[model samples]
Target: MSAQRPPLPPFTEETARQKVQLAEDAWNTRDPQRVALAYTEDSEWRNRDVFLRGRDEIVAFLTDKWRRELGYRLRKELWAWTGDRIAVRFEYEYHDTAGRWFRAYGNENWEFDANGLMRKRYASINDLAITADERRVAR
Candidate 1:
């Protein structure tokens, strides 16, 4: 069995908040392998229009993402949770190769296994261009 990432579900408001924060912190690391550990080996994901299956695919996708979206920083808030599922609302700031900044707003739904490894994730996101001076995410 995999080690549990705790604050395991059937969440209270506080625990759900913690879970969201944990996810935010991990994503901020911009380390694909490290962040992939938060999910199950065969975890499935729908990120925007792309579909991914397994940690290997997750790692590859995130590596490509962070490379394209430079200086990424993110914040996530718990929208709701029940049983082994959680919903989150998040915003992230990043710049493209041309140094044009954008803020991405997204919602994610996650379902976790008994050991607290997320088994499924679905995300819908939209990006708004912003001036670098308008950035809200602190480095």
Candidate 2:
């Protein structure tokens, strides 16, 4: 049996909120391995324009992402949920190595398996260049 990361199917509002918070916390840690653990071994993801399959691809993608997107901090909110799926709206801020800061806003739709590991994640994101003073998310 696969490991279960709780707040599993048929989500209530509170559980859905909890799941979103958990994901937010994990992402803020900037640990690619830890974050990838939340998804299934065969998970499918569409992040921005990149398409990925399986944990290996997920890890590689995130590793490169965090390398370029320094000082990454993320916030995720539960937008809606039903059955084994949830929708989330999120924002994150990061600075590049050259010190240009950007804020990314996106929506993600997630589907989980019986064990509570995300099997599918589809994210649509847009990034805006911002001055440091324009940042609202405190690191």
Candidate 3:
């Protein structure tokens, strides 16, 4: 059975920010199963250019991502929210196995079910190469 995530829909600014922080905290853990639990079982996602369906696919994608994005740290801020949907702007820093660092900036639009489980997510992202000395996120 899955966890019943709360603060469901029709959000106030405070609640929306809380939701965004919750998502950021989960992603920072980099635990695929834990992260996948936030989404619906049949969730749909458009992550950059990849399209994914369902929790199994979400888990696989996140597994591949965290594998390549070593030392990942993320920050997400709530931009807007109404009804069961939210918009977020975020930045994350990670290094490749070669130790080359990058800062990725992105915006995501998420739609949730009544139970607060995200059913759809669309993200647009851009990555900039940065020197270790330029890194902003703590390891």
Model 2 ranges off by over 4 Å = none
Give the lDDT of residue 136 in candidate 2.
88
Which lDDT value does model 2 have at 54? 96
Q: Answer with 1 or 2, whichever has the higher lDDT.
A: 2
Listed in order, each prediction's TM-score against the native is: 0.97, 0.99, 0.96
**Candidate 3 off by > 4 Å:** 1-3
lDDT of candidate 2 at residue 50, scale 0 to 100: 95
Model 3 lowest lDDT segment of ten: 1-10
C-alpha-based local distance difference test score of model 2: 0.95
Tens digits of per-residue lDDT for model 1, 1-139 = 8989987877788888888888999999999999999999999999999999999999999999999999999989889899899999999999999999999999999999988899999999999999999999888
lDDT of 2 by residue, 1-139 (tens): 8999998988989989989999999999999999999999999999989999999999999999999999999989899999999999999999999999999999999999989899999999999999999998868
Give one digit per residue, the lDDT tens place, for model 3 in 1-139: 5556887887788878888999999999999999999999999999999999999999999999999999999999899999899999999999999999999999999999888899999999999999999988766
Give the number of the best model, judged by lDDT.
Answer: 2
What residue pairs are clashing in model 2? none
Ranked candidates (TM-score, high to low): 2, 1, 3
